[model samples]
Target: MLNSSFDTASPSSMSNMSGRWDFGGEKEPLMHRIHAYPAKFPAFITQKAVAHARERGVEVKRIADVFCGCGTTALEAKRLNTDFWGCDINPVATLIARVKRNDYQKTRLEHYLADILRSYARRHRLHYSPYLKDDRLNYWFDEGTILELSRVKAAIDTVPEGKYHDFFLCAFSNILKPTSKWLTKSIKPQVDPDKKPVDVLPAFEGQVALMIKALNEVSEQPGKPTKKAASIIVTGNILEMDFAEPMVDLIVTSPPYVTSYEYADLHQLSSLWLGYTDDYRKLRTGTMGSLYHDSDFNRDIKNLNATGYGIVFQLYDVDRRKAKATARYFADLLKTVRQCVKLLNPGGMLLFVIGNTEYKGVKIDNADYLLSCLVDEGFCEIESTKRAISSKILTPYRDARGKFTTDTTSRKVYAEEFVVTGRC
Candidate 1:
């Protein structure tokens, strides 16, 4: 059961919010970059949002990230010594988050690292018979490279129950994209038609080395994140979580950008290695549908009331470079907001780190739409800040003429993250 003290009703009188403030900051290194993710909001964005919640006298004893990609929100929460929990449909991502937030004994980590290395030295020279008949594999890597990756997977699968199992699994997950033919430019698994990719074997070994170094640096830090009191990563869809009533204190999350990138296909290599999905086409169902679909806004409307979670959207599909139909978009967005409200502990605050998207040459005012959802749902607006999208690492494209493009027609997104809060 959730604590009752934090579940009080909202203050009767509240102010209607109209504008935004500047909240630009730097990104966190080490973990967020363990592997590339196309549009992960910076750690600084989450940190500042979390800090803003603290200033309002909101007793954020526990934080929940519904779409806990790469574990940014949970990790920052752990660093601050706050109890944290999160869920995601992607198993590989959940695995990485679980490993990053694991409470490992320093001595045990050293022992586990040494054992994996020793095992690799003995069996690293062996070869593996390819299990999946993915022709794309040959296009991206040579025989030697694939065999080595097989060996790495074999070592982890064969390990006995120990503290390093999750750690080892994380090390394996980190190498998925880096060792593939995909460009490091986007977190998606994009095959560059212009260039022949590197062999997987050498890339696999290199990523393993980098993983070890990152773990070493983390181990050396003064105070590391131990495990959370309660941790969970649901493979089931977030829309289908089996819960009744508001059960969380704080909600921190960044849902997939409106029809921008396919999280599943981008990480397909990991899915293949981990034995999750064999068909790449299957990944689309888990992602926000793209603009090219024949149904367009109609498809979203079908999913709106079905989701049961409140997520407001004023987004332009950058792929087609146009704003989505507002009725269908807001309906789904309202459902997401409603889910957030139902999941909250009465007056619990919800934090959204969303950005504006340009669609069909028009900006979809997502922040304003979110505020409207709060008002309709019987929630009170707390505060908000808009930050210039300054972090260039996540932005990685230039038009044919070498100019920065803002329209969504060519799949371009300019940085403009917004922070919004409201009591449920």
Candidate 2:
């Protein structure tokens, strides 16, 4: 029988067991500030959980994040000198994570930046072929801004192969939105016509400096003089990847929310600029909840044993396509959960940082459904805590039609999220 002692209490009732889990606090660790990811969980959450496990005499030798977005868990694991493994469908995310965990010489990066600046300064009016074209290019950037960005790209291309090159490329990627017309405050990619584009060179230089500082801070942490832990980051679909039985000691991840931010569309600026793909929409198909219509899937939704099926069935009469899409999302997530269960060692802990949100006027209790899935997969509930999200990067408001919105007065979507833990 499933353990039933855990309480589903409100955020206000939860104790500050691990102090405050703050992402934007003044004392926030610089390691997680490497890149801005949509709805990324704070590193403090992972650290607190690991500390608790250690106190209970748990041997956390190998850690894995099935949907490791930008490698927050992996980085923390590395700091603690534990082997880490992570995978994601987003190539850009994998690239960022790999670079974040890599130990690069500060002097090498300084020299590379100097070379790029000198090369860039020599080109008084260098004209290079634009990497992107048509509406994709014009929609987010003006001609002048695109030209300046192209120059920076050309300079980045001159860096020698290996981690040094990837480091500069990541820096360039971080500055893409700020130097373009994309809305700065919005998670979804929306062009702000009135937004002024910043100068590419200075912005990129500043980002490089910040990244170097963060890297140095991480390396200077007081600990054993042991060698750095090995980390394996892969670009692959989570549902299809395999981890042999009893491979991982712990799993920490935040899976993508249903009908939330379209990750492929959100990262288009970096995708096109970095030449990861010519069509960003093509990358959308494999992602969860990418199918918006009934024709997109061949499977029958009625076959899945999901607690949220009743809500989806109700949605069918209102919007058949969205209903099928929601069903597909759950089906995909279940497959992923089962895969994760198979990989984890006996008694290993799986901690998911998830939030419940509404879809097409139907309340999708994502956290509850995930808990049910875990129980069905043979995991016992340990403890779950609901905490208020003080500062969130994802847009919390949805329009009347159940679409994400930037409307200031729109209803709040996920002001709180549950950090649920289960033992296999």
Candidate 3:
């Protein structure tokens, strides 16, 4: 019941591909620069996928991204004047995505910025009582830095409730890491003990200006405005949310890599500062590929392809617990794929942008497994394209044990990723 076609082109064959297909380019859309979310695929990828769908005569109307991290696909859909719906378990990610898609009046944003600045300047000696009082907070920031950040929060509280409120809050959220001891370039939340923190007010002000510029650009784009597109970004786990019926026209997303990035830990600054969660560690439990659990692996992975199981078994020799975790990751992804298929209408496309990575000493062929799983789910026609990733927010190198590493000598993983597309 599966129809599969293979492309056996060697790496040399892909070398002449267009730059738009390559994720390594330096140029990125201004709107996408709102936040430095780890593992975010470039906007051009979505653009190309949509173009290909049009060529195939698929009329695009409603687009959904179940694992919409920071809303890349949703934003692209908005630009094309398509109705968009997206969900992510990470509250911080949902917040950024929601704000990015909002079409705020430029004058109103400027007025709010002036008022917030005036309110912050009026406070001479702000107390930090309202801020999160976790030990991790103190560890990441000095007392004076914390106090200044409190002033910023206090000023943001003055903004009236609405999109403006969230807009300013997102600006404040963007400045948290730059004004803290967190390592600026590291994907993982590692503290640079000797690094000096930037002034929260100036950093926040600069970020607000950048956001406004991006917002203005979106408003001026041709065709129907983004606000008229009926885009909705919600905070919900993809596995639990019910789409109810086959309504979506297209599904474009890049699910989290297996045990690669701890999203909760990486976003602790935003989570604590935005009051999305008081306990960052607790947020990890709901995420896929979470290492926090020790439960027995699900033995019956109905749709996981042979390559997936083979990699897990290989990892078992190095570490049984890790292998079990890998097994659990694939099982969860399989469930998500099935749910996505339910929501997609007949002939709709599911484009998955995923990368292969190593676990311990074994290579996990995520692309192959994903293709196989989609075929098993009754996707009629399957095609995939590979592109070299010259740079990404996520570190490319990992240690021998599959842990993210900064050392140059560490083995490199995930230099290339595949954009696998399947039609229902």
Candidate 4:
């Protein structure tokens, strides 16, 4: 609340955010890293959020991540021996989240792996699926690579429809980036011309081995969840979901960014190969902060809250497109907050791990906007602090096109994000 206005403060240019709320205990579990996701916060934040809530006398029975990207909260809730309910708009995200939440028997995984290997061995790629003709797939995958990947997908499909089947598909999905012409560790997908990728079968085998190791690590832990600790993960926008009752005790999540990475674009490879969609852009529909919305700003501007209207008005002076996107993001998240309030039990806490961004020098104060929204919803005990993000796979910078990059010349991503908590 700088100068009684959020726009008064400039965006942080430092590599570290305030260095205040950056806290994590012990090493992160292997399962959290089995798949790469855009803007996945450190796993320990879930632990810290739960602890903070409990310390404040909130008895957390079931945890929830409304925007559950890669199931960090779901996995940590199981580790804490609690129930979980999460949802996401992206099928690719829910796939990884579901796989991470369930416990798999090593014997079953090994048995399925053996059969998949045999199936892959016997598979002769004499024929291709008609979907193989997708131009995007051809642009990112070599001919041989896509053929072998399709065969692997076919073999995994033979494992019957259940967690194991999803497990094998997830294994295949993680290997997609490494085994394709898609450039390594890039948010923006593009073909790597001089690269030679690994064969699909061995990569799948290694992925399963790593997953097995992760499972073993969890199985060996003492305080792991019992069968009663159910995890309910669904695929849909939270804004569109029906919440007739308060189901969650504590909500810990990093909401979607404003005009940032399009998740559908990032997961195009996995989304295509898994048959979730032929055109990934369709996945971006109704997603919060997505640039593609069939909306009339003039019609929508009447409903904008004070914080939203302020920022969007400033952004409109610079760039109308960004202003529209920002307006949409604010409206969606405000509605999302109302939904979150409905989902949380009375006295339950909602902890939002959000950050601020800039567009053409106009500040996009997501944290401030969320703070205001929460207050409007009659939340109490609200507090916020900056949390420094530290990880090898992360860089606090993005190019003009919103692709993650290390170029200092690009717009600097907040080295730290705000953890804003309020009790419903």
lDDT of 2 by residue, 1-424 (tens): 2435444543223323333343433365686787778777877777877765666566788889988888888888887788898998888888788887888888888899999998778765966555546469778887777878888888888998788898989999989989989888676677778899888888999999999999998888887546768889999898887666678888888888876768898889888889888888877867876654233334646545657576567768767776777778878778878988887888788888877776545666777767667767777755556767776558977775445678855535877787777787
Write down the RMSD of all candidates, one decimal each: 6.6, 3.6, 3.4, 3.6
The TM-score leader among the candidates is 4
For residues 1-424, could you state the per-residue lDDT of candidate 4 as single tens digits? 2212223343332113455468676888999988889988888889988888998899999999999989999999988889999999999999999999998989999999999888988888546765468898888887777788878887888999999999988888899999888777776666778888888778888998999999899889876444658889999999899998999999999998977878888899899889898799899898887788876787667777887899999989888898898888888888889999999999999999998876656668888888788778888777767776665347766787556776865555676578888898
Residue ranges of candidate 1 with Cα displaced over 4 Å = 1-29, 118-128, 161-163, 193-229, 289-330, 393-412
For candidate 3, give the lDDT of residue 40. Answer: 89
Per-residue lDDT, model 3, residue 220, is 71
lDDT of 2: 0.76
Query: Model 4, which residues run further than 4 Å from truth?
Result: 1-20, 125-127, 224-227, 391-397, 403-410
Task: Give the better candidate number (3 or 4) by lDDT.
Answer: 4
Predict model 4's lDDT versus the native: 0.83
List, residue by residue over 1-424, the lDDT tens digit for candidate 3.
2222244542223223344467433355598998888888888777778887777777778898888888888888887888888999998898888898877988999998999989989886666555646788888988888888888888998999879999998888888889999887676677788888888878998999899888877777767552577888888888887767887878889988877788999899889887888889978876887777554666633334676777787877878777877787887778888988988999998888888876545777777777767767888667767777876438766765445678655545777788777788
Candidate 1 local lDDT, 297-408, one digit each (tens): 5455445431212222323323322334343445546666777876788668888876655444445555656655666677765544556665654543434332345433
Candidates' lDDT values, in order?
Answer: 0.60, 0.76, 0.79, 0.83
Model 3 pairs in collision: none
- TM-score of model 3 vs. true structure: 0.91
Error of 3 at 225 (Å): 4.6
TM-score of each: 0.77, 0.89, 0.91, 0.92
If both were scored by lDDT, which would come out higher, candidate 1 or candidate 4?
A: 4
